[model samples]
Target: MDLKETHISELLIAGNIDAVKTLTQQAVDDGCSAQDILEKALLPGMDIVGQRFKACDMFIPEVLRSAKAMHGAMSILRPLLIASGVPMVGALVIGTVQGDIHDIGKNLVAMLFEGAGFKVVDLGADVKPETFVQAILDHQASVVGLSALLTTTMPRMAEVIQAIKAAGLREKVRIMVGGAPVTADFAFQIGADGFAPNAASAIEKAKQLV
Candidate 1:
């Protein structure tokens, strides 16, 4: 990798949003392709973030900051990537389940997925089972994430999964579940492919799922 790519990776890991954008543009001006910048710089930086977060060396706020920096760089590079026909890792459909209005965790997972290079289709909060099923079909998503902060809403995750199966789409996408009240045991009982305890694990699990 070029020195600029290495610098971009360092700046992104440091969560230097402004520097990330500036250097990404400079890399482009210096003849670095957007795909090259994404693969060599941004993705590597986020990969480190994932590793550190999994190891507890990094916390949620710090990970979020790095994600923000990644977004800043992507703002300059995503259009170019699109124009160059660069494909994303995969599409992900995510939402806070029905009867659950809290989206903090779901939103964080979405951002982390985006930082990890997935094309995320976020359905926001209070999402119905059918909505999740349709979003999976609509996006042709490779993964689906269900979130619920309340115990009452946790059952909705299972319902959503069942809906996917009813629609004959359950086999098409890997399902993941998370939230304050969700556990891996519950996720397994519900037939989910994975469970994410936090944002970093969400990225890791999604990677494995894909």
Candidate 2:
């Protein structure tokens, strides 16, 4: 691996936005494809961030900082990736279930998904079940992620699954549920395909779903 590639990962994990911006632009100028920059630099950086966060070596705020850096690089690469026809891992629709307005977790997951090469359609906070269903249809998303931070709003995740099923699109996508109040058992009970307690595992689950 080149030193620049390692520097990109280091800058990202260190949450150095300006450095990442400079490096990404430099990579592009040096004839590195958008896909190469992503696969070699950004994604691998975010993967380390995910591992560190999961291992408690990094905190939420720190992870968000790293994600912000990744976002910066992505902002630079997005249009280029499209122009060059870079293939995405998949499309994913993610939202905080209806009745829950919390967005920190949802936003983090969305950014991480983007970093991992998923075309994410974020429905934002306090999202209704119908919105999730419509997003899946609109995006033809292979994976749907439901997040609910409140125990009371956790059932809204189940309602979203029901709505998708009612729309006859249950077979069209794999559904994953998450948030502080969600569990594997609850996900199974609600007919969710997967459950992740945090952003890193959420990426893993979403990738598996797609």
| Top of the candidates by lDDT | 1
lDDT (Cα, tens digit) per residue for candidate 2, span 116-191: 7888899998998899988998999999988887899988888899999999999999998888778899999989
Scanning candidate 2 in windows of ten residues, the lowest lDDT window is 78-87
| Residue runs of model 2 more than 4 Å from their true location after superposition | 1-87
Q: Report residue 47 deviation for candidate 2 (angstroms).
A: 20
- Compared with the true structure, all predictions reach lDDT values of 0.84, 0.83
CA deviation > 4 Å runs, candidate 1: 1-87
**What's each prediction's TM-score?**
0.61, 0.61
